[model samples]
Target: MDQSFSGSIRWAGDNSKCLDVQGGSPLVGAHVGLWACRADHPNQQFAWTEGDGRIRWLTYPSLCLTAAAPGLPIQLDLCDSPTAPFDAAAHGTKAICTSEGVCMTVQDTEAALMLMMLGLGSCFLMMTPLSAFWRVTAAADAHDARLGRRLGWEQPGLMLMMLVFLAMVLMDINFCPHLGREQLQLMLMMLGVLVIVMLLMMPLMMLMMFVFHGALGVNGCG
Candidate 1:
């Protein structure tokens, strides 16, 4: 081993626990996760890859944690191959720079990226329905006429919000070097929750409006 560390490998995002194999299995291809660290647990012991960013199991130095593909569960495999693709994406990374080396565990990075991607997709999907609904439906009684029209498509307000969100995401790359993993994780989690709550509230808001109008009539008369 190039460098050995005695402490269990705690997750970069959550330091309360340590990386461990499922069911404490020493076999090849065992799935890994964060588990409560115990001094006697062989599965928790790991060597820090300070030199190559390749985490090695202390009990089995032959096995190194590797991601077989993007979005796949990481597993322990022999590090014997010389031509193995340690590509950041294959390891489920948001990105990989040769200058920086591997940054974090594949699953953790993949999950964070996937969550953001899915949120953006959801926002886009909602835009299509809203645009169509506003166009086909007549609200002649309504006082406001601003439907966010463009050359062809609509929903300017929503599209602007999405653009702003994307800008923040893009800007974060420049901001990452200054922040630690835990702080970055907290920011990601907070942003995720905010977006999710905002989306969910749209339905709740519609429901509340319907209930209010039904109870007191649309014209405020019983």
Candidate 2:
């Protein structure tokens, strides 16, 4: 790595926070995140190595700030590791910094594509389970007054609104270079996981609702 300027990389959008290594850990995959700027935190120190734009951790010069892959969190990795994804020669994790050294960002077409796939694809997948859940509920033959009533667009509409809000927030990366690709990727992955968990719980939730409503109907009839 070509050594250049050394300093605490602060978020340009919010100067109060600086880039930090999670737990000050020396582990290869230790996460990188933003933290309150501290003048003396070794984990907050970084050097913008010029040529390849590698952000080298000054405390451990051999470890470079690396974006392991698209849709994954940023982490520390050996500067010259021979591993397929960690190979420094590929320069896949190279970052571009502002002239004043206030911010940094990794620009990669692949990473952007992965973020889109994870966010939009997962939301579309959720529609199937959501539709099925509503269908099952609508078809239930219980003597409850609400049986056979089809659900309106409210549920899915709310989900889509939530997704839109998330995307709006993540889109700040374009305006604020310091927002970082990993943060966006991590959030998208989280959205995907949340959708999956909701899908898995749909059946159980529907079953419980039926049991509770049926018990109410029986008691009313008695």
* Candidate 2 per-residue C-alpha lDDT over 1-222 given as tens digits, one digit per residue, 9 for 90 to 100: 565456565432233555688788988988777666676579877765656556678899888866533345567888675321211221111112222221123223222211101112222222322211111101122122121222233344336644654564455444445544665575466556544543445444345434433433443421
lDDT of candidate 1 over 1-222, digit per residue (tens): 555233354333333344577676777777776565455477776554445645567787777666554335556777663312232211110222112132223234433221011111222323322211211111231222232322122333334644665465445535445555765565466556545543443344334434433433332332
Model 2: residue 125 alpha-carbon error in angstroms: 32
lDDT of 2 at 198: 38
Clashing pairs in 2: none
Candidate 1 weakest lDDT stretch, 10 residues: 130-139
TM-scores of all predicted structures: 0.38, 0.38
- Residue pairs in clash, model 1: none
Q: After superposition, how far is residue 55 of candidate 1 from its true place, in Å?
A: 1.2
lDDT of 1: 0.42
